[model samples]
Target chain A: MSIKSIAFIGLGAMGAPMAENLVKRQFRVTGFDMRQEARQALVNAGGHAADSAKAAATGADALVLMVVNAAQARSVLFEAGALEALAPSASVFLMATCPPGEAEAIAAAVEKTGRHLVDAPVSGGIAGARGATLTIMVGATQESFALARPVLDAMGDKVFHVGFKPGQGATVKTVNQLLCGVHIAAAAEALSLAEKAGIDGALLFEIMGGSAASSWMLKDRGPRMLLDDAPIASAVDIFVKDLGIVLDAGRSAKTALPLAAAAHQMFLASSGLGHGARDDSQVVRAYRALNAKPANDP
Target chain B: MSIKSIAFIGLGAMGAPMAENLVKRQFRVTGFDMRQEARQALVNAGGHAADSAKAAATGADALVLMVVNAAQARSVLFEAGALEALAPSASVFLMATCPPGEAEAIAAAVEKTGRHLVDAPVSGGIAGARGATLTIMVGATQESFALARPVLDAMGDKVFHVGFKPGQGATVKTVNQLLCGVHIAAAAEALSLAEKAGIDGALLFEIMGGSAASSWMLKDRGPRMLLDDAPIASAVDIFVKDLGIVLDAGRSAKTALPLAAAAHQMFLASSGLGHGARDDSQVVRAYRALNAKPANDP
Candidate 1:
């Protein structure tokens, strides 16, 4: 059956606009958040406001968990009775960035209830979320993928069915984070080395951004890296968390990710240096801190 | 005085075409190489071929050293008497990817002899050399830059006067190599983790090549990484050597480049595993060897 209603939990910056986009597509979108303003913002955007996750999922064709973490998703579904409230044989789209192992466990539990689970995770950050241009990676059975396609189309233009395994989409996302985090940290390392030799950071990036040294992260975050304080586009703690997930994925799969592991250390150091809340580009600060010369040196 | 007669050393894969490009631009070009065919290739393209470095440099306004390393450049300029053979107050464009410290030393020695040394290193590889589209990073005084401008423009379209100090251009090139090496190895690590989870490597790179995960190295070397044997665009030992230079530069400046140091190990292992002559993308093999599941484990 087609999805006419979507129960979207976690009405934060990403979820609110995503739920609103579903509502604009003529689907009945009921969104639930602990914050009244968040729920009200979705309501103002023509989505229904729900006081609880269970209320939002009642009779909905699909339930999308966009909450903060796997534990929160679990609380909403099992503890809050959202799973039981969904219509019989309805699909659950877990769109949060969860560990692959956790996603697999969640899938088995969801499948036990005679419902389908679409393992979906996203990239593209706030602007992509607001503009409905997010890149969504899905891991689901062919049946669930068909069921989720039209609804997923409402929120993202770039959607890929990565694999049929329940945790494969999460794996793709974990890998994506691995590349992004490593690239950002590597850019910091490169820029820091150049600055140590007194080459202008701006000029170095201007040359690198057009050369084989370029990365999406370098072109996007490189200018901000030159600044003493760049406004937060994304916090350093996000990569601290994301690369943590990447390492966890590697461990579970018994893979050694030396580059990712080293990159994560820089993010962890940046966070420990109290720049966790600062922009991700501030990871360069960690490099600077580690490599700065002694005051007494010539 | 304007540069007219030019001496080009090391007429190998990159230098042969570079000398030919200078010939096409109407410079009175004379090139020398150890190999007869390399020198003949330049001669066939309308440039003259000299039997020795000193013979090529005799009375030339500019000497372009595109040799393999600092040792070879030193041999050609000092031991081979090319420095003394140059016209009065001539300029030397050292275009090898040498360590920044070595470039500085070479410049000092050249300056002591009443000649200018422009520390110029290039990227874009053999293809860039042939098309004269190389990105040349130069570190020279204003007078040296003015003298080298028209002559350098004949070989590379993107010529950057990175700094006045002789080693700064080499520093930028060192940092550029740092980013490039880390990016290639990071792509391997990311792809290996995805494959460990049974996700498709091509699909993973396709998603990543569009997302923030993308790098010039990933987009260029990623596809070749999936194949069992990819025809060599660049050998793995190239990075093995380049990242070595990067680390040497970092060490000289007292900077701790953890990411670059980690990436160098992977390239080193790939070379140690007897894939040194293989394509650089085969750094993935080091990752594969590290992370492969047991053959006997069912």
Candidate 2:
């Protein structure tokens, strides 16, 4: 019941910063990753690096999975035998963005191993994760959320218990991605149109963002779009996966996700044009190529 | 150069309230409309009512056109004889939502008569119009914008001089509408997906709006989407026209507008379903019909 030791899996761009925050907050943290450099990075940051996922889970009060998808989260636990290696009373918090149904299924699998599962999905990007201000959406039993509150509080500024069902967090995250995908595409189109019309894209952004046209996507992605190439913060295929989950969830609900579907195609086109591994803002590259006008040129 | 007399044409929901605001501000306002009741409503509000657009334009230093589209705006000015009646140095502010190219054409026609044209588009819905806090996007030469600044100040709190050309206002407005169209559809899809998953739609709105999924559309349209019969504010076909302009601009620029195109279909379907006159948020109804769970139903 006491939160002392924790295992953080998947030390990538987001995960590494999140794990560092936990260690900074005085938690006994052990990190594990397949990448030797990632493990070394954690070891250099005053935290122990586990030899394996199961080794990290051993004697830990909580195991946090910050992997890419459900497949990796599953492999880290079930396939790697971390479920059997962790303390019987420990909790596993899956913070990866995955399909809602998969989260539910995984929760069932984790519960059968005599441990608690908190389907927690974090938002606000790596910046918020490192700042410990990320918004965490939780879908778990009230008891599980209560037990995980202290640890989650150390990582996120705001935590909402959206529902008692295990998959609801992922469900909300999917919906979030749908909006993000559509808004990003919408912003890119607007900027391109303005630029084509010989209007200043940056000035147009300032005017539109102050108007009813303003969106989180426009505000977040608009400036990044002004740069043709930045480091890949979040990839185009990330939306390809997230919006794919959105469309799939919509299909299951028999709901029509027209904008999300359309945005999905744009990301697909970006991926098709060999920018899949680049930042999601690179979706603008697809439009830029099609329009044949460099945004910075005119 | 005295600014005592003003004429307002095309007294629709927005125009009527706008003219009334001018009257309330103690301006010598004359309102004209094809709809008798629209004019009568202005008269009822203590403003002078003119029988024809030309009569209203005669002797006025400023004329504001709040008509539907470019063709209608042209017809009122030329065919309806308003242009022939205006004073030589008068300023005509076209406050309607029209395309940039059309605005440019209209500006050319207005300037041919030695009159100035201010391409000013207002935002903030009927409530904002009534409250006199609408945001006005104005595009004009320095003299024209200066001539209309006080008038725009009387109508809106935020007056942005987007550019020096008449079409630039329309261009900026089109950009705003593109994001507006995409965000509304995105909000609908996100909310519907959450509702379909047995998650509380209201709670989902609260969570997503507070999270990275947040946007002006989600805040503006999310609650109205929950109403059984959404009150008509802005109709669905409005987005149809707006997105049409957006996509048309994009296509003319050879820019891809996938999100706008997708959002366009939802509005088109809403229009086709006989909900064109309903609130734009009623696009959620399209998702409802597909899901067989009405948005208003808890």
Candidate 3:
């Protein structure tokens, strides 16, 4: 039930906080990342730093990959020899938002190495990551889920077993991102209309938040959309990647996702407008450019 | 503050229940509609029945228009001579999902007749309407809002005064519909993909509904989507009207609403498939036809 030695990879904003939570919960955590500062933050939180993912995974009972996308998750666990380095019975939790197909492939590759693979993608933003209240959706054998329970508990408050397929977690996560991305863009569009109509955006937020139009994305991204400019937590490129996964998944299944496609285009337009690195709420900037002003100029 | 005498127009699913609520709450409600059965149902609920909207509005303290669209609202209040029949200080609570422009024009027309107007579009679906727990969004002057508050209390649990602008309530309602329309379509698309991927549709619904993809629309529409068929509470034609209003509003404002437009297209596709009068969740039927069944459809 205890994670004696765990390896965490890609300690970025989300991963760093999650890895720290694991360490703070008294797990002997070994973290690896190309970003020295990210790894250093995990190290400062009582986790050990490793030079490579393989080094971190060697002798660890569990390996958690929190990389940016499927490519990174694959590169670290499969390509970089980390899967081979892990103990035969070690459980691997892939928490990155990636293509479902890729998750399925990676899970198969890990399973081939005689290790348990937990397709665990999480929600709840940076704040949740640090506060250890994230929601983790798992698509794995019940055995693997049970094995990874302690580590998951250290990282999230809610852990659900979605299905028996490795890609189910990624599939559900893509759906979440599809809704989140579309809702955020929709919020921008509606708020822009309000602002163009001379209604105060703040008051609109207050009213809508309490109304049926309310969603997690609106409550989270609406205020940030009002900020003229702000620091980025989740960047625009994340949606570009996430929504691309959604569209690709839709296309693969021959299922048309018009709203997701439209949302994809806005994030594309936002990225195309050179705000890709900015906060995802910067998608509002696309709306601002299309409509005149969503807020009075400071 | 008491609503002793009132008229309720458009005795359809929502309007009939709402009219009954007024009667249940001790208001002397006069119900009007072209449908004899609809009027009879209201009369059975102890409300007076009138053959015309003007007949209902005449000498009443307030007239609540719960019609289908702006055209019906316009025909009743303007074209049908209801405005001329209502008392000078009588209030008109326009509680239908119509275009913001229509709401604004109606408000102005009512105000010129020395009548108070409250743009009070509602949410909570048919169930909410019947249960008297609908959420009402009001856009009226302080005096008008205060005047309509008692009647609103009879119909809804929450009444939000969005702004003093006549169209503000419709604008906010349109925003709510925008999210609902897009979220429902997105839920359909996602659930369709999950089904195509060989996952159980009901299980996927249970999983995603418990996860971050959860939204008011998704949770509300998801179960119905799983059924090959279900009763039509709201229909695809409804979204066709609502999302049409959304896209038109966005286009007139020159605001880019790519998500709403895309969601609108899905509803159009469903309508084209001849399921316009079926449940709006039947949008998934379009996906079902286009997508190949999972390998293990047993």
Give interface RMSD for all predictions.
0.7, 1.7, 2.1
DockQ value for model 1? 0.89
lDDT of 2 by residue, B1-298 (tens): 7566789998887888899988987888899998899989999998999999999999788899998888889998999999889888998989999988889999999998899999998888888788898888888999999888888888898898888899988988888898888888888878778887777878888877887678888898988899889887788988988999988877666777777887888888889888999899989878777666655645
Model 2 TM-score is 0.89
Give per-residue CA lDDT, model 2, range A1-298, as digits (tens): 6778999999998899889888888898899999999999988888889899999998888999999889999899889988888888889999999888899999999899888999999898878888999989899999899998988988898898888888998898888888888888888888878777777777877877787788877887888888867577788998888889988887766777777888888898889999999888888877877676755754
Q: Report fnat for all candidates as fractions from 0 to 1.
A: 0.91, 0.79, 0.49
In the range A91-158, model 3's lDDT, one tens digit per residue, is 99999998888889989988988889999999887878999998887889988887888889999987
lDDT of 1 at A101: 95
Best candidate, TM-score-wise? 1
Top-lDDT structure, candidate number = 1
Per-residue C-alpha lDDT of model 1 across residues B147-244, encoded as one tens digit per residue? 89998899999999999999999999999899999999999998888878778889999999989999999999999999998999999999999999
Model-by-model DockQ, in order: 0.89, 0.62, 0.45
Kindly report which residue pairs in candidate 1 clash with one another. none
Evaluate model 2 with DockQ and give the value: 0.62
**In candidate 3, which residue pairs get closer than 3 Å at backbone N, Cα or C atoms, i.e. clash?**
none
- Report the CA-based lDDT of candidate 2 relative to the real structure: 0.86
CA lDDT, candidate 2, residue A182: 83
Go through the candidates in order and give each one's C-alpha lDDT. 0.92, 0.86, 0.84
